[model samples]
Every structure is written in structure tokens, then in C-alpha cells.
Target: MVAAYPDDVDTLVAHEPPINAVLPDAAGAARARAGFYEAYQAKGTGAGMAAFIAMTSWQGEFTDEYFAQPAPDPAMFGMPTEDDGTRDDPLLSQRSWAVTDYLPDAARLLAAPTRVVVAVGEESAGTYTARTAVGMAGLLGREAVVFPSHHGGFLGGDFGYAGKPAEFATRLREVLAD
Candidate 1:
């Protein structure tokens, strides 16, 4: 039940040929055409073509709407960093990009869920994954809550699951129960 980008899911399940490689085929072409129509209607020809190009090229970028407002305090969040101290790992970067790429689909799933909560480790804001989680939560009309670490700091290098799983679980249970 974990929702993710079509491409990310492909990565997880090891889909061959990748989803982007098939867009020019019959069904994909039709869908693309329809998508262009919709985009043009909403945003005009130039923006629509831009979107279409981004879609086909797998170069979709994240926007503020993909994140929540009054974002979790940055001081408390810490995204995963490379050994060189850069917050850019290939997989994590892809996850972030995929989240942005498939936002419309994710929004649909969020709308259908009876209950949804977006959680991010206080340490990942501004990073791709954190931003994705924030964006997804915003689309779903859910609040993004940052749980404190064992040391009471907000940031950790782990993917929002660092420091005291039990406490975090308990907090999550409480939130869900409410």
C-alpha cells in the first residue's frame, strides 16, 4: 500500500525497459495527446509544451505546491548526506524527482484515502525526499508532523526513522487514534 512514483515503483519491482521508454507507443501517444490538450486548456500552448517536454524527458522539477507551507523547522531536520557532506545520493535523488514527476497521480491517491498522514523526519527539509513528503502531504490535505529524536533534536541523517522507533511508533499511534 506504499504509494510511490510509477518510475520509483518500477525501480522497486525492477521493471524492465523503464516506463519513460514507452511513451511514444500507441497507448502512450494517445495519453500524451490527451494530456497535452488538458495542459494547453489549463495553461496555454507554451506551458503545455513545456510540461510535455518535461514529462517525456524525465526532467520534471519540484515546485512549492509540492510542499507544505510553514514547513517543519529547518533547524530540526537533517537529510541524508554523502560522505563528502552533500545531500545527494543517487537513489534518494531519484525518489525526490519521481515524487515531483508523479505528483498528479499521487494527489489522486491521497484524495481517495480515508485517512492519511504525512510524516517526515525533522531532518530532511529542503532535501528532495522531505520536500516530496511535504508536497504529497499537502496534496492529500494532511499535516506533516515532525517527531523529535531521542536527543530531542529535529534532524537526523536517517530517512525520518532515526532514533527510537518505539517512541516514534507511539507518537504515530496517538496521532492516528486522534
Candidate 2:
């Protein structure tokens, strides 16, 4: 939006967008992503979620060691081990791969009037999205603005992953005000 309709916005707070193209080992990352998708297709939601967790929780670059790890067990994460034989999951499937594969147009965004503030959670340091946030900010000749919590910081307890929503909101207000 900032690149296309630059005049329609002022401050664009992009919070921890998981653009794998921004990573150093983008090909490795894509491979790792495909591994999880494969897990989903082979197993079920449980195995897929387990693999997804492993992928997301992995720190630093996607090294050979990352792939050498054993396949995650669904029961380990308290998930079902049964294969329901369904593959329409939005997150586990390749449906959202385009979003992660997106390579941001830095020059176009910089030329725009919008102030793009790439944000990452303080607790998400060293994570994939955090690194991408930093990389995205670097592409814009700036540093990533630290947010209050994790990736889903703004979310409430309804999602079972509660974060500092109040503090996150306050920080967001401060960032937008600036």
C-alpha cells in the first residue's frame, strides 16, 4: 500500500512481516518452509503445526544443522498425531507462500511520502521475522522499531497466546505519533 498509494497514508507500521526473501539464506528458508508444507500434506494438522513451530522457532539462518534435526512429533507439542488427510489449512499449506516470498521494493517505498516504520517485538529477537524486520528496515536505510511483545503482540487471550496488548498499544500510539 505504501508503494502503490503513497499519498493515501502517512505512517505505515509494518510489524514483523515474515518476508523470507529478506533473509540471507532465502533459498534455504524456502526449502525449510516446503518441508513444513510437506509435513502437513503427509501427516495432518498436528504434524504440520509441529513442523511450523520448529521452523518459526529456529534461530539464526537456516543452516544444514536446521534440516538435520529430527522431524517434530505432534504429541511433543500436545497436538494430535492422527492424520486427518486434509490439506486446506491456510497456514500450513502453500497458500500464503506468496506473502513470504515477496521482495519489498525499497526504492519505490523510499521514494514514497509514507514513513515506513518496520517493527519487531522485543521478545522476538533473533527470530526469522525479527531478522526480516531488521533487514527490511536496513533496506529503507533505517533500524527496526522495537515493539512491546512477540509476533502476535497485539492479540488478546482469546487466541490462547496472550501478549502485552496494552503496552503494545501504547507503543504503537507513540510510534504513530512520531
For every model shown, what is its TM-score relative to the native structure? 0.36, 0.95
lDDT of 1: 0.39
Best by lDDT: 2
Candidate 2 per-residue lDDT over residues 79-101, each given as its tens digit: 89999888889999889898898
Kindly give the stretch of ten consecutive residues in candidate 2 with the minimal lDDT sum.
155-164
lDDT of each: 0.39, 0.90
Q: How badly does each model clash, as a count of residue pairs?
A: 6, 0
RMSD of 2: 1.2
Compose the digit string of candidate 1's lDDT tens values, residues 32-121.
434534544454444344434433332123333322223222123242111233333332223333422332444444444345455655
TM-score of 1: 0.36
Cα-lDDT of candidate 2: 0.90
Candidate 1 lDDT for residue 167: 65
